[model samples]
Target: MLTLYRPGTGWLHRMPAGPKLLLILSVVLVVSLLPAHWSTAAIAALVAIVGYTVSGLGPGLRGIRELGHQMFSLRWIMVITLVSQLIFMGPEPAVANTARVTAAIVLAALLSLTTRVTALLDAIERGLRPLERLGLDAARCALLLTVTISTIPVLGRRAAEVRDAQRARGARNNPQTFVIPFLIVALKHADELGDALTARGVR
Candidate 1:
């Protein structure tokens, strides 16, 4: 499995997961509230660029380069979002939507690259502890959030692998050929993950 967490001594790496997650949420909400104009897209793109700069500064550009590769892994999804939004909402809104989505993706990839999965889960559980009396399962809720964050890269890789394998087999690059196999691969991974989690008594 490809791990998104990159070990680093950068400030982002040193920052606690809880505040990092909150920062991500705050940026996302801010971006979403902006008017769907070209300026909105520009501001969102600037935010993502700034995030990359901070990730690399003081630690050299290495962190930024590594994070960029992780971000690039999700390019297919980004492209699809761009095309679909363009078709449904036209160019202006499409640009804004895609920029916002890209910003969100950058924030998410940043968190996963810097913070350990366990640390993320622990932070989530601790935050949710106060609601445990309301019958919430902090451990499970934390696990769910951790899994959701971590799955982004894994699924991206899976789709790429499936597409490559089909191409190697001389299959035409059509939506049907790619999508079906990708879903099968994703489902298989889901089952394996479930079994692993169950074995660890995470259920």
Candidate 2:
């Protein structure tokens, strides 16, 4: 899945999707390959702080709180990343890898928050149009990617909500319990989305 765009009236909201995407990509590249050292860790932390704090995506603290909410939803992934790295690699690598994931997730989440899904779709479609000569349905391919991107954050939120609800009820929240309901909810959302797209005449 791809994104969960939130409406805002900041500079980020007004920025074009193409450039925003390129910027995010650059960040992911930089952070993903960062050295697993203390200095790099501090740099990674600095980048993250600057990203979440300086970005005028929302009204002051409200904006920061929104990012925090998204991060909370992704707690499991971060935990697993750190744990896995710690076991297979070491503490430094664990920290570095976790930082990579967090930065990518948060920056990506920010992109989705400020930019419209339609805009992303259009940008992607335009970029891929030249490949239509190879029998590619540019529009369909774009829609597929757009849908993928759009569902990611929503699905993550759904997972978090379902997990929380199961905990609240004292139910055993294992993969089976979590996966089954998550799949069902995802299917339902897909069906609803399909109908919405059909009504809009989007093939």
Q: What lDDT would each prediction earn against the true structure?
A: 0.80, 0.78
Q: How many residue pairs collide in each prediction?
A: 0, 4
User: Over the stretch 1-118, how does candidate 1's per-residue lDDT look in tens digits?
Assistant: 2357868788888889999888877877788788889998899878877787877434667656754665566677888998999999999999998888877776677788788888
TM per candidate: 0.84, 0.79
Q: Model 2, residue 31: displacement in angstroms? A: 1.5
What's the CA error at residue 122 for candidate 1, in Å? 0.5
Regions of model 2 farther than 4 Å from truth: 1-3, 133-137, 170-180, 183-203
lDDT of prediction 2: 0.78
Rate residue 146 of model 2 by lDDT: 70
lDDT of 2 by residue, 1-203 (tens): 23576677778788888887778778878987887876676776677667777667666687678777877887777887899999999998888878777777777777778788889888888978999999898888888877765666777788888899899999895876887887888788888888878987876
